[model samples]
Target chain A: MPERGLLIVLSGPSGVGKGTVRKAIFESPDNDFEYSVSMTTRQKRPGEVEGVDYYYRTREEFEALIAEGKMLEYAEYVGNYYGTPLDYVNQTLDEGKDVFLEIEVQGAKKVKEQVPDGVFIFLTPPDLTELKSRIVGRGTDQLDVIEKRMEIAKKEIEMMTLYDYAVVNDSVPLAVEKIKQIIKSEHLRVDRVIDSYLKMLKEL
Target chain B: MPERGLLIVLSGPSGVGKGTVRKAIFESPDNDFEYSVSMTTRQKRPGEVEGVDYYYRTREEFEALIAEGKMLEYAEYVGNYYGTPLDYVNQTLDEGKDVFLEIEVQGAKKVKEQVPDGVFIFLTPPDLTELKSRIVGRGTDQLDVIEKRMEIAKKEIEMMTLYDYAVVNDSVPLAVEKIKQIIKSEHLRVDRVIDSYLKMLKEL
Candidate 1:
């Protein structure tokens, strides 16, 4: 039987480019992981395809999944719910295909509770100064609002201690390369591959 | 001060091509690690250099170092003493230059006792059947001797569980690539890198 696939969780504080790095990983022709499409109550944007961009759901539908614990982890923002579908993630992994989750820090924390074995990668800005600049570069918030955002970012950065790998997002390509290295290395970990060797030993 | 560099221990069963793979790594133009030159009482070959190759030593001197607990790990083979020097490995690591030790499985186990944090990699033959064939193909051992070698190889393969990563030596370049990934990934592991991130967070 094929070995079970890794559950790769990519997350970071706001504006750390988690989405961009995740996109680069998918755009690479050689990437084999199945991106876990999230279910959301938010309106689908133009050209978005169902089951591709997201599994759009109504308020009641999302709440029902939560009630049934079908959502692996969910959080509401602006009166809309977003979460990972537990069944799809499990099915993909059972098929020996890795599942990649790109989510916010809060959602990542919740995912950790249920899937503690998942490879949690916390992507960070090069430093807090850079992170602040990225936030300010948005050019969309007031001084007080930016300070509030920085405060929230600080709290999320502190949560990095809970992660298994912390990658500096110094550059998109470099970050993607490091993450790929991490995934490949994780596959070779003794605990993951020893059982196959043990079975081979028995045959020998 | 810079973080201490990793002590990379690469070992596997006899005939698994550990030496060939280790040579490939060092031969690579971008390889940055300092190879830990082992001290040996065996006569140096015609073209061998003193420090570049083995640190040729007399049997008496080798025994004195061992008695003083100055050898990191050593073993006597074919009436010749061979071992890694403890001082060189420690001093190189303290200087933040990674030290690579390519040794036999028995030597690897002893090094593990002294440096438990070292990244131990086990290189394996594709399978025991293939391993047996490699032994038989050597064309030098008698049938009974071949069987005895196979027995020793089996025992060494069993020691793979003590390693952190195991790469099957199906091909040299692929195994080398996997080992490189393992090293880069090791550098990124949370336990290895969290302190800098914590200090950065404190400053923020």
Candidate 2:
């Protein structure tokens, strides 16, 4: 039997470096990961390529897809609609290529409801202190915004229980290596082995 | 909160390189695996160390341990009693070290009943052809014995579903590496994370 691809849903609290770790893994020749392009009604940022950065769409088109039940999950943030399209994910899985859904806690939960077999992973900081330091080091938000973000992060960390695995993003290279190992070992799980080999043995 | 160790139960069909891969992993400095010694009535081999290899015991003592429910799993083979002692395993786990139980299918099932949290792994050859070649290469068993072993191997492969992970023994180094990843990832599973942090996080 041909091998099936894995749907890896990666979620984390704010400032856990999910983007950095994911970039390192995908850039390295060792991993073959496809980024799932989300459909968004928000204006495309400068230099963000269509279908690469996101599958940009109008609000009406996005709402149509949602009503058609093609969206795995969707939300309106600051009046912009963002959603995960189900067709592309299913197609990629059928082609035996892994697709990563790098989302927040709420989005991850929604995806899990639709695709329960996907590998749900939560990225974490080394500790709360380090997480605070990382968030401060970014130097992007004011004190009030930072405090609000910290509160959200705490709540999200509590929701780590909703994930299957928790990866600590202490360092980009190390975190990428650990996640790579997880993907490799998950392929060798018993359920897959049984699905791939069970009935064939009887014929042989 | 203190971290807990894992009970790793490794099982495979006869002559499937279970011993070879296990030896390679234990010999490596990369892993900190503790070998669980079995209480056995069989005579120890020439080079086999007493506590390191097997805890040699009289039948009376072994039966007494079994009656006391001290045996995690016990089996009789060729008029010799061999069983895993629960005290030793629990002690090793308390020390926060991974313990390997290299037993066969029947003993593995028994042990699973007692230690339901153990990570049960089934090791396999690349295929039956490779398995047959490996057994024939050893040149130890008669033709009838080899045939019987092959039949048993087939039956054991059918029971691969009983395991959590299935490591194909394509190469000793590769198999060892896969198992290492499994151990590392299992440590990061959400259930363990919850067990280690659920109560402590509330205090913060």
Candidate 1: list runs displaced more than 4 Å.
A128-157, A200-204, B128-157, B199-204
Off by over 4 Å in 2: A129-154, A202-204, B128-154, B202-204
| lDDT comparing candidate 1 with the true structure | 0.87
Cα DockQ of the candidate 2 complex: 0.44
State the lDDT at B59 in candidate 2: 94
How does residue A97 of candidate 1 score in lDDT? Answer: 89
lDDT string for model 2 (B67-154, tens) is: 9999999999999999899998888888888888888888999888877878989998677434545446567769887667567656
Report the lDDT of model 1 for residue B109: 95
How well is each residue in A1-204 modelled by candidate 2, as lDDT tens digits? 346789998888767888887778789996786888889999999999999988999988998999899998888899998888999998888888888888877889999888888898889877643454544656777988767756765676678878889888877888788788888888888886675564544443
Q: After superposition, how far is residue B10 of candidate 1 from its true place, in Å?
A: 0.9
List RMSD in Å for every model shown: 4.8, 5.3
Q: What is the lDDT of residue A199 in candidate 1?
A: 64
Report the lDDT tens digits of candidate 1 across residue range A100-157.
Answer: 9999988999999898888999897776535645557677778888778677766766
